[model samples]
Target: MAKAFASQGDLEEKKTSFTEIGRGLWAFTAEGDPNSGVIIGDDSVMVIEAQATPRLARKVIDEIRKVTDKPITHLVLTHYHAVRVLGASAYGAGQVIMSDKARAMVAERGKEDWESEFARFPRLFQGHESIPGLTWPTTTFSDRMTVYLGKRKVELMHLGRAHTAGDIVAWVPDEGVMFTGDIVEYRSACYCGDGHFADWGRTLDRIAAFAPQSIAPGRGDALVGPDMVAAAIESTRDFVDSTYRPVERVVARGGSLREAWEAVRAACDPKFADYAIYEHCLPFNVARAYDEAQGIDTPRIWTAQRDREMWDALQG
Candidate 1:
């Protein structure tokens, strides 16, 4: 039987959980669904990665109210994927922050991505009508930006291009906890449709330098403690390198796209088969890796039609 395309078959909703990784810091994860984070400081709260809609984001807000009543004053878009950014208005945050490159991506492809992702994952788009429109960051920084929630400080930095061209991670210096958007996925398939394979591995090296005590990845459970943090980073590094390296080798041998895709699926599926979004992401992942292996640097924007065309090209 042919597998369902992207998330079309993902009808079952996941149960969400809030794991407190540090004092006043929490990771909200929903079983491979897009995850979010909350950081409470002395004066206010900062949310990392908004859910897909106001209704979904309210659930995170509800979780926030349980621990701290601090107003959600800051919202950080780790990158401009619609699942991460469209829910911005729900928080009524004073400042919506993103990397300058990310802001440009949003401006350039936000509508297409919004349409593209919505079609891919319908389950994540509950209450989609409530979303006002494309999420625009009120503030954008080139390299790094710091926000002080009283004495606590949260720093946003674009380590390098990995998951997306504009990918960024949130680092809490005092807490020693990092919120890596999609740059790292723990035990979950790395969605490299918009990723830079070589740069991603180099970027992961930069993340390792911080030696975060705990790390919240784009998907999967939070990595608590230094040992777990290191393991997850290495695992993500390995996952990216493993999946793409094999495909790269095949492409260098003048293999067809199908051959490259088969090489990656054969290598990755044995281990990552049960990982979140593995089936949904594999084709796109292979397509991008194939292009990158052939020396494409910037990832092409994905439209709903582009997604289907690639899916059919590989799976038909």
Candidate 2:
């Protein structure tokens, strides 16, 4: 029998947790769902990574109301992914920010991605009708941009490419905490369908160089200390390396995608089998890694049709 496409089989809702990684900085994480970061500035708050729909985004807003009543003034998107950006309208922030490259990607393939993701994981889009349309950033920066919420300074920097070509991290200099989008995940599978596998490790190195005391990672639990921070970074690197190396070896031998799938599962399953979204991410990760190993510099856009075609091919 053919496997379910992506996360279509995943219908059970995950328990949500709101963790304080630093003073006034919170991480809103679901079991293995996409995570969002909250940075409570002196006068207002800034949210990173919107949920898939406005209804899910409102859950984060509800969590925010518990700690402080400050208005959400900024919504900073780390990259252009359907799950992360489609909920922008709910925030009603004065500014919605993304990297210049990310904005370009939205213009290029955002609609197709939205359609693909909605089909793959219907559970995330519980309130699909509430989503107005594709999320666009009102402001964009090339390399780095800094915004001050009164005395607090939050720096948004486009670190090297990893999860996607335009991935960025929000660094709170005063608190020594960083909100790394998908560039770093804590025990959660990295979704690499649109990733740059070759550049991912270097990006991890750049993140480690900062030695952040705390981190609100893209998924899983929030890292609250140097020990946990370092471990999560290294583990993420290991996950990326483990996934790509076996596929690269298979590609070098002129093995087919089916062979690469087997190779990746053999290498990754023993260790990452229990991780969040491991099964959902494996097929996409293998496809991208196989392409990258064969000298494909850019990941191909995945429409709903392409997603099913790829899944069907791999099932064989």
TM-score of each: 0.98, 0.98
For model 1, residues 1-316, the per-residue Cα lDDT tens digits are 6677789889897999999998888999999988999999999999999989888899999999998888999999999999988888999999999999999999899999999999999988978999999999899999898899999999999999999989989999988999999988888888999999989989999999998999889999988999988888888888898789999899888999989888987898787888889888888889999999889898888999999999888865
Per the 3 Å backbone cut-off, how many clashing residue pairs does candidate 1 have?
Answer: 0
- lDDT of candidate 2 at residue 35, scale 0 to 100: 93
Candidate 2, poorest ten consecutive residues by summed lDDT: 307-316
Q: Kindly list the per-residue Cα lDDT of model 2 for residues 1-316, writing each as its tens digit.
A: 7777788889998999999988999999998899999999989999999999999999999999999999999999999999999988999999999999999999999999999999988999988999999899999999999999999999999988999999999999999999999999989999999999899999999999998999999999989999999999989999999999999999999999999999999999999999988988888899999999999998899999988888887753
C-alpha-based local distance difference test score of model 2 = 0.93
Q: Which residue pairs collide, candidate 1? A: none
RMSD value for candidate 1: 0.9
**Alpha-carbon deviation at 276 in model 1, angstroms:** 0.6
Q: What is the lDDT of residue 26 in candidate 2?
A: 96
Candidate 1 ranges with C-alpha deviation above 4 Å: none
Error of 1 at 275 (Å): 0.4
lDDT of 2 at 252: 94
